[model samples]
Target: MTRGKLFEVAKELLNRELLDKDKCYMLDCHTEIFVWMGRCTSMTERKSSISATEDFLRNEGRSTSTHVTLLTEGLETARFKSNFVNWPKKEELKLYEEGRGKVAAMFKQHGYDVKELLEDDHEPLINCRGTIKVLQVNSGEAYLIPLPDQSKLFSGDCYIVQYTYPGKGRDENLFYAWFGRASQMEDRVDALSHMYAIADSTRGFPTLAQVYQDNEPEQFFSVFQTLIVFKGGKSSRYKKLIAETGMPDETFDETKTALFRVQGKNSNNMQAIQVDQVSSSLNSSYCYILQTGLSVFAWIGNLSSTEDHELLDRMIEIINPTWQPVSIREGSEPDIFWQALGGKTEYPKEKKVKQYIEGPHLFAVTLIEGRQRILKEIYNFTQGDLTTEDVLILDCQSELYVWIGRLSSVTSKEAHILGQKFLEMDILCEGLPQETPMYMVVEGQEPPFFTRHFSWDPSQAIMHGNSFERKLSLLKGGSQQSEVSVRNSWPAGSRGGTPEGSRRNSISSNGRAKSASPIPNVLGVISCTSENQLPYSPSPAEVKLFAGSSPQNGSSDDSLAFASSPALQPMVPPDNVRVDQVEGSDASDNLSIYPYERLKVRSVDPVTGIDITRREAYLSEEEFREIFGITKTAFYQLPKWRQNKLKMSLHLF
Candidate 1:
């Protein structure tokens, strides 16, 4: 689509009270179409067009005259109003017989102009070849005025006239034309004139590109500054406008240029500057200025006096000053301008991780690629022995690991880079031990079975292996030892290890499971027996089958370990039990377990986040009283600050 058509559609959409729901439609109909059409290459063009259209309509003034212009020859018989409804066909038309007469009539009745032509012997009106002009013809008067001479005018220079529109083709384009002084006019085909036509095609209203050219910079000067001022505020509207301008906020440096200044309170002698809606009644008046190629604000007056107008005049003088306007000075110290206003500690910035060899510190380095890997390989070479003595190897591959390991500490950032270096290699050609301690065999000693073939193969690293479980399996322990397990509560009396409260578990020949506790152990295994077996074997969907432990046979002569303790008695009857489907519960949960300290339970709190750990649950009255005893009377007697002090000292009590 032409820029004009797109603009027209945009204008119609923008004028309406856009609802939240209309945004998607706007993107689909307007934004996406322009992108698909390839009309909007950069954000600048679309943003500038939208802004110009909005501003043009917002600032549009009522026209003082109703007359319209038309271009035609000065022949009497050629003038008539019948041509308004139908035009003489282009190929078959004769000028005096139809075209000239029809166009002239409209000019006589209304007022029209021929911008660049005169009546001649051959044609009704013809001057320069292929040239158009503006004409002024009233019912009683007839004459034409040629376009002004601008051979010497410079680019960006413009003029407005009380001129009328020419004939049809001219009206389609020429909203306004710009011209340069003679020597600067570029070659005469009215290239400057085409700018206006381009601008006119854009819909809604004319923009700087349509109504004024870069040569006509004056038309934009005051309005341009005003646009920036309007956009330079903290409000959401101003923020959006600022974004539309494509100007970075950091570019508006205040140090070198006095673009903005805040006026003192009680300043009523201001000119056109508007007050911020939020604090309009404040004592000080804030005046913004665009003096040295940047935007800044200044406080113009105080409560005792009103000197706002005087200050504005002074500022304008600084900006425009003498009749010969000079270019504003650009800022030299870009670093200062770009520096954040509130000092360095403003936002969270990336930090380099640190690595340390000994103490409580442990770091992992993943090898990336490059010479860094070679350096890391050199360090791994000396892993056969580690001694307190410091050893130094200068870029040499021999005795590298022992020399580096002696260093007191290293930053995590260096370790991370080293890790990246390690990953860049192929096979197990080179390797370096991470800051994390790994058991290594001495040069002449036999390595343990578990460590026998452990190679530093980056490709074979397991991302989610349960190292704790693997290590637990490798640990030496008692014969017929119980598997490392986890329980909601202590396994009967194992917590404090009391005698009469001791818990006993029984195992049978088969791999059946059983748990009989006061609470039915919430979710624990049950052994299968012919006489006392559950009516049906628990399906996978029903009860979870645990590994390791089996059920005991019901023979009286047997140890009957399941009945050795009173605490093992089942508290809940089978009829009252409700079973939730084991949807995503992990089967690994029934495998080798972990110690209590390593286990975690999670509960959700809808409004907050997941509340884990048994300690988060509600406490009984006695428990609450026990916690409050330390603060009992002191909290009530203390002042608010002291109370806060005590509360913040959470562990001191």
Candidate 2:
């Protein structure tokens, strides 16, 4: 095989998000088959038939000059090799039939029951006969059904044999799920290479072959670059330019070289390289998934930047003027640098400031001090870290809470609930745990002191790490400590227990409070308790409707709870806006891509009622008031579906 072609093949394989090494080799082998074919095609007539090449391939171990082209994309190497292993010349069938006794004798030697043989699609030269029993396929790869006494083959070790004419389809090929052994495959591989050489000798290279061959291996197959198969546009012209310069020559004119667009797989905002960067092919798909998910959060700001710092400061100053900064750390390191009160002690040693990992960002708060403290204690106890995690509390209830935190090696169910909430809010969180581990080390000890990790609350050992647990002297609260339970501060209307609106909002990386409380009218925090009661609230329906599906799971919650509706949710003024400028018009004056899309509920009179099907079913708030009997003020204030409809329409447009 040409080293240049091998490098190209490797480059193509790397660009995929393949998870395992085996896939890499499989793809590599398949690429060799293609490359071999390419070499043969270079010397052939341009209009060679795919079938002629296929026939050459089937003439196993034979070398002859027969020019032809074959469409081989998407076929596994083993399968492709199998197709050529037993090529049947038209004269061979009569001879084989005459020696039926010999055929049955060979089958008996091979341990296959002669009775099991059956008729199959025939090649012109041989009346093929074989029985193919598909065993099973898991995760996409298929295996052959073994004899009653034998085990099925392992993944990547299986092969198939098939016969097909160029004009006829794959069905014409005599397909087999079982092969003789490894030695047989080696023979097949050699035959395939020779056949490809003969076939390609008659046909010429694809248009851009020269360009692909000329560049340096790294330039042609670098981790940071992508392999693009030009299908349309000025691709032919670009190929001509490359051919003129030769493959290895530098022909870097933008107009002449086909643009490498990130529009293909794993393209993230046009910057990501196209080919798989990792050696293993298994990670290829995930590369795309990860890029798409993270692109949404890529431009988010952290506290390190002056602008982000100012924004964070302004947010905290407006939202929690009374809140004090408490320095919490895991492993004696602060994951978050430059907290409101704490500064870095060591550079790279203590913590490195990165965008998402242990970085500070402005966020809304939901829980008060006590609940925040409890959640933090739980996080520390469960995660086994003492420094470098931050949290922001959003809102909480009896069973669930909403919060934000840095990724944890271990996360609570409570943390996952927060993750779900963040997902709802269009925030992507990675590494949130689903179930708590059985054993967690508290203050660096083994078994006896170990505590079962809880999703929302930390174990008893964790509480000991916090100052409150020390004061309460509840390190070993006997049965109370062992029971999975939540403690309520009993003084009614007092801030002792979770405040009236106090629920465990989320915490950051180290499980520290993300925000101090859920107080409304605060610029950066949500309210735990509202001063105004909701009006004419509709009772939640026992029967649930499929509101929407989560990306991971498409399940509908049968029991839904009512909290503050999106309409009741406070809307803060935009920190930035999009604008366009022209000679006559200032860019800053223009609105964003779609300014009309905003959430606003429209109400209509029951008597006049909207024609759900006609008359432009959706109504703006003003239209809602005009058509509905309700007053303008009431229309805007209406909650539930009315408010949700507005938010939906605005977001879509």
Candidate 3:
């Protein structure tokens, strides 16, 4: 679609690969329009923004007064760049442009105007407004007959319905032979042979299908205006008549359009309601199956979830099992889809509820001494505010997101169950409905919806800086600090997801500072990940993972709170390394407080492929390699259990 013609791509499907350096694209984000021109684009193509916008507006039935902005590669706005996944840094653009001067020259000579405009022909033979004829056959031969009133049929008869689209360049015929349940087999065989004979002579070979009684497909019911069944068979009342045509010239009729909503969370509760075919009736929280003429489309709403998708899939199997149905997600609807809904208009962007839409609220979920525990809200937060050890919740209006770091104690399962309860509690506590859509995303898999809240520098994608940072550090005579800073240096009021206290950040609104103070060692006595711990107080615990009346404080209960993985703590320094530089490292017992069971065990030799009693880690990677032999990458490729077991066996844990 990026080669020459303008087209829409699903927001979920948009990524860096779609932005080819040799092509151009226009993203229509409802109210706003952005035209992206690649670096190697031709001069003619570069100046075609106005024409493109006009064509786009005229096609989409939008006003010409709508704003259209132009953007070039590498100089795109933060909002534009956030639309894609794994969006490359500007340095990658520079590198690609470094060797493309000659390629640009060659492209300028020909330009994009020479490219062919591609389109598909959609004139279907099995349409309602086309020429339709019915044939009746006994044991001998099939003969033409007049259309029966209400498509009334007798149980003892066999019939062939032949559909043709005349004077539309689609001369081929569409044939369907329907056999009644009580009809004789010999009569049905004779009808099919006669139907194919006429079809071969008419237009070489035509599209044909077989339909049995009581097993009609959606197309069968939709193609025919009405259907009625009787209890009798062939009689003397049968008469042959001329073929019939209804409103042949009026091809695109809205009366033939049907819209069905495929909704609900599970099979037992799912419903497919036949709603009015209009933009106003469209819901953003459900998938809709629309039938425009013979074409079918599955319009996926933005607010619909994975469960809805599965329901839509089942609905599709019933509505258009064999036919090719166009699957289009919300915001990327095709022009034809808009045409079916009488041109795009205002529609709900999310599931409507009694509660008013509000800005996001964040919470941290942490594990206490290897036990999952709930933490409270974080004030004045930022992307750099999320720690590697704690699980954070981002309540984005109607949508909620729970982000788990790579080193967080909460596994995907634990997050799905407990993180959900925490989100529900947060919403219910605030007097809002608990039916808001929730999603649990892991580190690096952060969707654009979640990432857009941050005003991220492409260079700061990783914990460490890019090559530019390394070069800058070299020029500054290297950093004097021994340990790397856990958070990025950013001021309040900068970047999206600036946490709950947007303008009320700890530092002055305009001042530059790290997102928050780095996590404190707390005398190495604290074992949990949270630095700003809020009390659960004396509330009754919802989950019985730990047995006690109170959950805010640690108890002697041995039961695991959802999981057994230990909560990540601050980076531990070796005994020889001095830690006074870090806050609260002056304590005599600088080592983190570990469970008594771990300190008493002997070192485990996991690499030796032997099952032994666990002990304090003593083998270094060099000794591990000398003893067993496996590269770090290979070890990483092993199953997570193997990797975690190896790490636990080593003193590293």
Candidate 1 vs 3: which has more TM-score? 3
- Taking all chains together, the TM-score of candidate 3 against the true structure is 0.29
The prediction achieving the highest lDDT against the true structure is 3
TM-score per candidate, in order? 0.12, 0.16, 0.29
Report model 1's TM-score to 2 decimal places. Answer: 0.12
Query: What is the Cα-based lDDT of residue 411 in candidate 1?
Result: 22
What candidate 3 gets wrong by more than 4 Å, as runs, is: 1-356, 370-372, 427-435, 458-461, 464-548, 551-560, 563-653
Instruction: Summarize candidate 2's per-residue lDDT along 153-255 as a digit string, tens digits.
Output: 2111222322222211112112222221221233323323332232233221100000111111121122112222222211233334346757432222223
Which number leads on TM-score?
3
Error at 422, model 3, angstroms: 1.7
lDDT of each: 0.24, 0.24, 0.50
Off by over 4 Å in 1: 1-261, 264-625, 628-653
Pairs that collide in candidate 3 are: 453-496, 453-497, 455-495, 455-496, 601-615, 602-614, 602-615, 603-615, 617-651
Model 1, span 522-559: residue lDDT tens: 12233323443222222132222233323443222221
